[model samples]
Target: MKLTLTIWRQKGPDSKGKFVSYPMDNVNPEMSMLECLDVLNESLAERGEEPVAFEHDCREGICGSCGFMISGVAHGPQPATTVCQLTMRHFKDGEELVLEPWRSRAFPFVKDLVVDRRAFDRIIESGGYISVSTGNAPDGNAIPVGKEESDRAMDAAACIGCGACVAACPNGSAALFTGAKIAHLGILPQGQPERDRRAVRMVAQMHEEGFGSCTNIGECTGVCPKEIPLEVIARMNRDYLGGAWRERKNVVTTIAPVSDWDFAKK
Candidate 1:
């Protein structure tokens, strides 16, 4: 098959970038999206041109190191599929595909299709952990967990931290990602000790990361390769509110600014 690609190309973080067009031919339908890019790079290398830079670790979908916007949709219009798992057959011959990196303030452009997702790393560092002592593994049934609770926690734990949720959102929100992190641990018995503080520190770090607030548009979950649900966002909000109430004498945070009239009256 033959296709045209208009891909965003940035040499570096401070470099000016633009869409560079390339006509691709003989593209095998079975070739994964990243494999297609690899073919393009091979052609560029033969011509003594700089190859387009993109990120991918395991060609499999587990690493979450590979993702990008394909033709205005995150992961190329496939539901619950990662780019590494997307194949050329999904698109028609002669189709013009536009490729770009994930766009978010927290995720600054690195190169061609790579964005700095390290902001996610910082969020995890803030509190996405439970204290564990060094010892032999505990007995399997030491702590009995209900099937429903275990299933929900496992569902939340499926988040791979791919930035598709941030890219698909109009608000560029990380609430879905952050919430998944919170819920996965919060629902488990081992994660109970740090639950309250984890919510506070993680939420605070999320704000500090410059990610936009979630308005519940549901786009994040729509493009998620793992099919992580929107329910995790609600769980995160509930935990955050509970933590805030306990820490601040029942005060809740708001997007609205302080009213000057009320201040003057006081």
Candidate 2:
């Protein structure tokens, strides 16, 4: 199918950006979105034109590297499908698709369709791991973990850190991402030692990264390619509250909520 792609192009972080349109003919309906991009790049290269820069790794959607705004929606219109897994068949012939980078203060644009997601790594570094004796991998059934708890942990652990949560959120909040990381470890026995501390440290680092607070708009979960539930944010808030209650002296908390029509609402 033939399609028109309007892609955002920027030279560097400080450079200005604009949408450049290209008529994409000869696109196979079976080709994944990233594959379509590859075709475009090949055409550009043949013509000695600078190709668009986008992120992709393990194009199977396992890696969260491939993500950007597609037609004003994260990962396109499909639910729980990353851009790499999206196929050209989802679009109709002559359709115009707009692609842009994930917009957030924490995710500054590096180039065309690429944004620096290092802030997520910093949050994980703050406290997304557990302390354990270093050695060979332990047996799976060594610890008697309940099936329910394991399921919850697995659910939270599915987060790919794609930053779609931040991009979809009207407030540009990273609460969903941070919450997923916290819940992934907090629900497990091995993560007990740093459970409360993990919540505190990670939340602190998230704030430091300049990400906005969660407004409970639910847009984060709406765009999450992993389909991470909104309950993860609630879980994170609960953990943060518990941590603050326990370490009242150290948990410097300041919460200022935003409402679109609070003061003027009838």
Candidate 3:
């Protein structure tokens, strides 16, 4: 199949980006999007042209490293699929696929379709962990977890932090991503000890990162490659409200001027 790829090209974070169209005459229907890009890069290299820069690792879709807007839709038109898994067969012959990077203040543009997602790492660092003692691993059944809780935890754990949620959201909210991280652990017994503190710290960190507010428009989950439900956002709100209330006095001083509890209004 042949296709026209109108891709955003930016040399650096501060550089202006523009759409540059490249025509592909020998795209294989079975080739994944990244594989097709590899073919394009090979051609570019043979002609001494700079290859398109994009992020990818574990192209099977497990790493969440590969993502971008394809024709105004995050991760292309496929439902619950990553760009790495999207194949040329999904598009028609001579189709024009417009590719762009995730647009968000928290995710600064890098080069081409790549953007810095380190803000997600910072949010994880704020308190997305359990406080377990260093020693031999405990038996899995040692902590009795309810089946319902376990299932919900697993569902939330499916989030890959791909930034697709942020890109899809008109408000550029990170609520879905942040909520997933909080819920996966908050739903499990292993996370109870730091549940309240975890929600408070993570929410505060999310606000500090400059991500927009989530108005429950549901766009974030709509384009999620994992099909993560909006329930995680609700769970996050519940935990954040409870945590913020309990840690009101202490949190006020630490995250001053941020108004973390303001999220509850939304």
Candidate 4:
């Protein structure tokens, strides 16, 4: 098989980047996407040219590190599959594939297919945690949790913090990501203590990081590798609203400007 790849190439964060084309032959359909790149890099090395830069780990799709825009989709044509799991057979014998990094103000390009996702870390640091002390492990059945509640919490917890949700959105929204984070903890009794403050701080950090607001277009859920449902966004909104009502007397601490507007319009 033969194919042409048009991939973005950037030397550094401040460098100007452009798409560079490469044509190759003898591609095997059974190879994973990263393996296909391995072949391409070997070819480039033979010609004394620099190879394309991309991110990957485990190559088994668990790390959520092998992320880049394939053709025009978040992780190629597959639904709920990461790029590392994407195989070459998805394409025809002779085809053209375009590759680029995740695009968002919060995720600046570091190189060809690598971007700075530290904004996500900052958002998590802001409030994506429970206040439980680090002590001895508790018994498994010490706290009673219904199956339905535990399942929902796990669904939200499935988010791998991949930026596909943001890349797929027309507004580059991080609501799905942020919402998943909030819903995971908000649904669990262990997270009750910081629930209100978590919503306020995390939402504020999300906006400050320059991620756009959700338009409810459903693109986030569509491309989510974890298949985290869009309903998580609704749950996030509900928790935020409930938190605000509980703290209505002390408006300054519980309400975030972005979330306040969203709640007011509702």
Worst 10 residues of 4 by lDDT: 253-262
Q: Which tens-of-lDDT digit does each residue in 163-213 have in candidate 2?
A: 999999988899999999999999999998888888988898899778998
Checking candidate 1 for backbone clashes, the offending pairs are none
In model 4, the clashing pairs are none
TM-score of every model?
0.92, 0.92, 0.93, 0.91
**What's the candidate order when arranged by decreasing lDDT?**
3, 2, 1, 4
Q: Of the candidates numbered 1 and 4, which has the greater lDDT value? A: 1
Instruction: Kindly list the per-residue Cα lDDT of model 3 for residues 1-266, writing each as its tens digit.
Output: 99999999988765667999999999999999999889999999999999999999999988999999999999999989999999989999999999999998778777898887888988888888898888999886998999999999999999999999999999999999999999999999899988989998989889988899999989888899999999999999999999988874554212322222223223
* TM-score leader: 3
Cα TM-score of candidate 3: 0.93
Between candidates 2 and 3, the one scoring higher on TM-score is: 3
Model 1 RMSD in angstroms: 7.5
Task: List clashing residue pairs in candidate 2.
Answer: none
Identify the runs in model 4 with alpha carbons over 4 angstroms from their true place: 248-266
Could you give the C-alpha RMSD of every candidate to the true structure, in order shown?
Answer: 7.5, 6.8, 5.3, 6.1
lDDT of 3 at 146: 91
* Clashing residue pair totals per candidate (backbone < 3 A): 0, 0, 0, 0
